[model samples]
Target: MSADAVRYLVMPNPYLSDGVLDVRAVQPADIEAIRQWRNAQMDVLRQTAPISPEQQERYFAEHVWPQITSLEPSQVLVALERAGVLIGYGGLVHISWSNRRAEVSFLLTPELEKNTDELIALFSRFLDLMKQLAFEDLGLRRLCTETFEHRTRHVATLEASGFRCEGRLREHVLIDGKPTDSFTHGLLAVEWKNGQ
Candidate 1:
C-alpha cells in the first residue's frame, strides 16, 4: 500500500506498569521525534553512523510507514508519558501469517538506557506488552531480533527477556565503516508465558 494511504489507530498496551509509560500508535507528528531519538543512538541502535535527515525521511517512507499500516504489514508503537513525551518505540517486522512469526526491535531515549537506573524495569514492561501482542493479539508463535555484538545492553535485555541466541553472524554488518558481528535471538510463546 502507498505510504500516504496508510492509517493508524491508537491501541492500548496490555503490558502495564505503575503508570510509567503508555504505548500507543505513532502519529505523523511523532515521526520527527522518533527519527531524532533513533539517530541519536545510531552508535548503539543502528549498523551505520548517524543517519542524515534525508535518509531518515526516506526510511520512514519506504520502511516504517509500510509496516504500521495494518496487522498485515506489521505493528509499530511508541511509548509515552502522561505529558506525551516519547520515550521509546518498538515493533514487529517481517511478519509471516503462515508461520505466525516475526522479528522484533525496540529502542529507548539515550538517557533511559543507563544501566544504573530503571532500564531493566522499563524494558521488561515493554516486552510484556509486545509478547501479549504476539501470543494473543497477533497469535504469533515466535518472535526474534538481531543486534550487533557491541550493543551489550540490548543483548543483555534480550537474554533477560527469555530470548535465546540462535546464532551469530561474524562481521555481518558495518558500523562506522567497520565490520561487526551480529547475534540473532529468538523467543517462543511458551518461553514467554513461563517467564523464562
Candidate 2:
C-alpha cells in the first residue's frame, strides 16, 4: 500500500489513572514534541540523541505520520498527554497477523520520573489498551517488548503491569560503542485479562 494511502484505524483512547493522562492517536503537532522529548535525553546513563528541527520535520512527514496513518488493523501509535502537554508515548509496532504478535516501545518526559506512580499508571493504561486491541480487535495471542538492562525502572513498571521477563539477549546493542544486554518480556492476552 502507498505510504500516504494507508488509513488510520482509530481505537478508543485508554486511561489507567482517573483524570491523570489521556492517550490517543498521534497528531501532526505531536511530531515536534516527540522530537524535543527525544532530544532532551542528554544526561546520566541515558542520552537523548539530538535531532535537528529539519531532520525532525523530515521524519514526521516521511516516516511517523505515514506509519500511523497506514497502521495495521491490529496496530496503534499512541501519545500520552497530561494537562494539555505531551508527556509520554507508546505503541504496538511490527504487527504480524500470521504470528499474532507485536513489539511495543515507549518514552516519558524526564520530569515525570520523579513521580514514579504516575509513570507506572501511564504504562498500565498503554498495556491495557494494547491488550484490548490484540485480543478483542485483532484476536492476537501475544505481545512483546525488549528493554535495556540499565532501564531497571521501566522493567519494574512492565512487571508491575503484568508482563514477565522471559529471557535476555547479551550484547544486544552497542550503546556508546559498548555492547549492552537486553531483557525480553511478554504478556499473553489471556494472562492480561485474568490479571485485571
Candidate 3:
C-alpha cells in the first residue's frame, strides 16, 4: 500500500510499563541509539546496511514523527527503556488497520545479546508488553513475526509468549552469502486471551 494511504488510530497514551521496563513512543533522541543497535545486529535484521545519521534524521522527520502525531499511522514504533535509560526499540510495524494485524519488530542493545539469561528475560518481558499494546490497547486481533531459523533462543521465547509457528520459508533470506530459512509466527487475540 502507498505510504500516504496507510491509516492508524492514535493511541490515547503510548507509554506502557510493568514497574520495570518501560515502552514509550520513539523520540528524536532515540534515533541514534536505534541506528547503532540496528547496524550492529544487521545479521539478525532485514536491513542490509548501516543507516547514516542524515538518513536516520530524515526518516524520523518524514516517517516516524508523522506516525507519532497522526491519528492513524502505518506503524507504532516505541523506545524500550529501563530506569530511564534506553535499552532498545521496536513496535508493531506493517500494520493493517482493516485487518487489525501487524508485524512485531523488536531489538535490544547489541551488548545485551551476549548474555543469554538477561536476553531471555528482557525479550520475554518486552513481548508481554507488546502483547498488551497490540491485543489490548490497540484492539488488534492478530500479531505476527518473522525470525531467522538460526535464532533458536529467540524463537523459543516467541513460542513461550504464545506465538505459534505458522510456517517456515525455506532459504527465505540471504545471510552472510548463504541462504537462510525464516519461520513465520502468529498469535491471535482470542488465543492470547485464552492463554494459549
Candidate 4:
C-alpha cells in the first residue's frame, strides 16, 4: 500500500484502547521512561549499554518522531498506558508494506516482570491490540516477534495469544556471558481473525 493510503486508513486518530489499557502514539515525554525500562531490562533486550539522555533525545528526534510524522514509517510505535499512567510501550516495528508483515516490539516496566500472571494478562491484551492495528487497521498479512528462550513466560504469553513458534535460533545472543537461544513466533492475519 502507498504510504498515504496507510496513513489515511489510520488518519484523525490512531489511539487504540481496550477499556483498561491505552496504546497511543509515543510522545516526547515517553522517551525517558522507555529508556529507563530498556536499560533496566537489558538482559532481555538487544541493547548492550544504557542510553544516555542525549542519546535518547537524539534517537527520539532522529528516529521516533519521524516515524510518527512520516507517511511511510518503517515502525509504528506507541506508549502503553493504564488509567493515565504509563506502564509500557511497543508496536509494529520493522514493517514491510510489500510483504504485509511486521515484527512486534513490546516491553513493560521492569517492576511488572515480577508478577507472572499479571504480566501474561497484560501482554496478551497488548498482543490483541497490536493485531487489531496490524490486520484490521493496516491490512497486514502477518506479525512476528523474537525473544530470548529464557523468557519462558513471555513465550507462553505469545502462545496463549495464538502465535506459533516457527523456529529457534540456537545461541543467537549472549546474556550474562552465556550464549542463549532465541525463539521466533508468528501469527497470520487469517489466524487472528478466525480466533476472534
TM-score per candidate:
0.78, 0.79, 0.93, 0.93
Report per-prediction Cα RMSD to one decimal. Answer: 4.4, 4.8, 5.0, 4.2
Minimal lDDT window, size 10, model 1: 9-18
Model 2 agreement with the true structure over 49-151: per-residue lDDT tens digits = 6888899788667766665534354456677777777887767776887888888867787777557787677777666666775677667788899888877
Query: lDDT of all the models against the reference?
Result: 0.71, 0.70, 0.87, 0.87
Model 4, position 148: C-alpha lDDT score:
100
Clash count of each predicted structure: 0, 1, 2, 0
TM-score of 3: 0.93
Off by over 4 Å in 3: 1-9
Write one digit per residue (lDDT tens) for candidate 4, span 1-196.
2233223224235678899888887767788999999999999889999999999999877876666656557898888999889999998889998899999999999988778988988899899999998898888999999999999999999999999999999999999999999999999999988988
Say which prediction, candidate 1 or candidate 4, comes out ahead on TM-score.
4
Error at 79, model 2, angstroms: 1.1
Model 1 stretches with alpha carbons more than 4 Å out:
1-18, 47-69, 80-83
Cα miss at 192, model 3 (Å)?
Answer: 0.7
Q: Which ten residues in a row have the lowest lDDT in candidate 2?
A: 9-18
